[model samples]
Target chain A: MTRALYQFLLWLHPPFFRQRFGEEMLWIYDESAATHGVLALFTDGLASLARQWVMRAGTWKLAVAGAGGLLEILMAGFFVMGPAPTAHVAATQSIEDPAQFSGTWKGSLRSRPIELVLAKEGTVWRGEIHFQSPDGALRSAPLEDIRVAGDSVHLRVQVDDSDMTFSGKLVPGTLGSRLVGALQATADASDDLISYSTLQAFHA
Target chain B: MREDLSPLVPLSPAILHILTALAGEERHGYGIMQEVARQSEGQYKLGPGTLYDNLQKLLEHAVVEECSRRSAADNPRRSAGDDPRRRYYRLTAFGRRVLLAEVARLEGVVRHARLRLQTNNPRRAS
Candidate 1:
């Protein structure tokens, strides 16, 4: 089953990519699959998808062919017939019930006020962030990978040239308030990692 | 006129690690991955996707080249059991210079950060 899933993920990648690094990738995946859980494999598959997208962006051949359009469609058909990767693994670790996240969260980092408006979407939490850019201009970006696992709350927001990830504990504060315990935010760029800290509070 | 390395300044961690991995000896993809993990103390493990993408970029930049099997044989250090299908890569002269320049640039940033930190926390400075 794992082998079939691995092959399906590999098919999602471009042919030139398979021609070059396919064997090595499979070798590594086999080793990793033996140790890591299903979540990790799914994460790797997502990473492979990102790499394929990058390749398509850089190469006209893949872009023009829609990354081997017919092959991808056939592969997708096969994938639909199989159990989805998401079905096998719980992506988010919900520490606090997502229902408790209904409200507005306001925090300040690097002297700029950041606001989060979160609401429950089925079993998961979804939200948008409003913040001031370096230029002091207001901007709102969709939250990416918002997860509440155990006492930890993790969310990623895309900023220009980088992605800012926040991982910290959720502290139940005074009535109608949720305080972020030891908030640590890391802005990851291709070349650097910049970090910031903030005292976060959300009010219902 | 010389080619400008400025455009490549503040090189991505992946590119820097690849160049650093190839600094002492030419390595195939798997070797490069192992060396980079070792260098980063397992903090930055490059999956095949990330590894090959950076390699493709490096090849395009003319900073790294894929060596032929004959050249690998010339090394005299490579093991006889080395896989023939494995493609080895090494830094070109230009790549070495870029690596050095990037290191220097990073050092400058570190120095500046230190100075600012000292100013921000005078007690720590003392």
Candidate 2:
């Protein structure tokens, strides 16, 4: 493993340097293998690459790398120390008959057709949602943290790389009646809505 | 702009070690590695990747340049039967100044740390 890592590190050098000093580098590796070992070699290889990137990369590429590294840290921190769930809608009492909300309902938001399949599990509501993504890819996302309270129903799903919370009123009426509500899509920690759209559902 | 100011002040350990090893005499790559390990008492060692990469940087910075005159007797790591393509490196004048400045900075840091340690320890304070 040490020999292989040493060869890999040597290969990272530019061709001209490799041609000039490759043999001497190998000799050094052989002499210092006992002291440096494989782990140190691997760490040095990474450090060498990072230094090369910082020194050699163009301004644009350096900016992109900086942004990418920052984004990764922010994303990891977001998950580890996620924002408290801000209630997108006022809480209401749990539905007396959650079973009435069960069955498939069709809706549209921003001109995109959406399908919602709701089911009652004892006192709670469970659902699955299907919609066409922005890239025109059909995505079926399981709705989570579903709560059905009286005439108000709320559920959350991940869409378009954003957390989308859909809260609407389920009015018991004729079979062809309309269910109306609003959708809140948040993309980051601020919990501010990136996009808010009205949602209308009809039994399909 | 401070154009005359040296850009190598905040030298990395690997670069500093390489410069220190070559300060007294010109040595090959392996020679630098062995000397650095010996100088640090085996506590800090530079792997071949790190050593060569910093050597490239130092060459670009003109702080150190390659020398072609190779004598196997000069480097104990090179055997009599070994290939004679050993590349030797020596620190330029600029590198010497940088090394001195960095060493002084390190000395100040070490002195302060030692003083604090002794002051905190009542037995040592006496």
Candidate 3:
């Protein structure tokens, strides 16, 4: 029956759907599978296959029908069965060594003061801009999209629409100095705001 | 209940984790990643690429909404002048309803299975 077919599709589709929605979907699936047994899973897989075939047929209604039919099956099962059981995943990295970029440096943008926080973690350098805006209020923006090569630093920041690159050299025991180059934005009259600067060095 | 079920297609594990993490409170991308890791006891880790991709999809579906920047009263960690570094997310009413319904549906399935298993096994009854 239509209900049986719907239960089957729920089983066939990989748990990718649950990942996008919520774990509740997986919980529901687990419950449904437990009640219906392997038959429900098999039915879902077969229905998915049939829909894939119909999609390849190149007709409009059949394609729509295949999609609509599959959807009906999921809804019917959802209302009757509830949520499916779900599994979880974790993140690979953690933020450590927060002090690497703790020092202060001074720079300028068109003669405006740009104070930076240069934190060094081993060799990788993280920089932050700590400066007062034109209104004399302190603000900060992360030096995102960083690329450090040897003693030279190459990075760009967006001010409005133009991307301005900062090319600088590392001065040992001194504030690194760099020149700003302007690049055209997709649109006119927009310029990227230049923020922080730092040399990329390997921490020994 | 039968208007259109296509949008409610079961989500992937990664997407589900993001949604589940946001079920109780709002969190940005990084916060969701951290919480999911903790909830799973570090078993299922989602990389940046996977996390963001799933987030984009969820945003499109309107299941999760971006929260406003935390006010000073809301975030104790806010430094005096530090720019806000985090984005927050929360579940929509529709999303909550769907999640609850799904939970009930699954529970029903589990109850039926338990009954069948017990009834089919005389040893279990004894």
lDDT of each: 0.67, 0.68, 0.49
lDDT of 3 by residue, A62-144 (tens): 44555565666677677767553221111111112234324665554322466655666675667665555556766676654
State TM-scores per candidate: 0.50, 0.46, 0.35
Docking tier of model 2: it is incorrect
TM-score of 3: 0.35
lDDT of 1 by residue, A39-111 (tens): 6656756686676666433344334454355555567678777633431122232235645666787875444
- Pairs clashing within candidate 2: none
For model 1, name the residue pairs that clash.
Answer: A93-A149
What CAPRI class is candidate 1?
Answer: incorrect
Q: Fraction of reference contacts reproduced per prediction? A: 0.08, 0.45, 0.00
DockQ of 2: 0.16
Query: Which candidate's TM-score is highest?
Result: 1
lDDT tens digits, residues B1-126, model 1? Answer: 765787787899888999999999998777888889899998987766677767766764557876644666677657888655566788878789999999989999999999998889756454
Q: RMSD to native for every prediction?
A: 21.3, 25.1, 23.9
Most accurate candidate by lDDT: 2
Task: Report the C-alpha displacement of residue B38, candidate 1, in angstroms.
Answer: 1.0
True contacts kept of 2: 0.45
Q: Rank the candidates by lDDT, best first.
A: 2, 1, 3
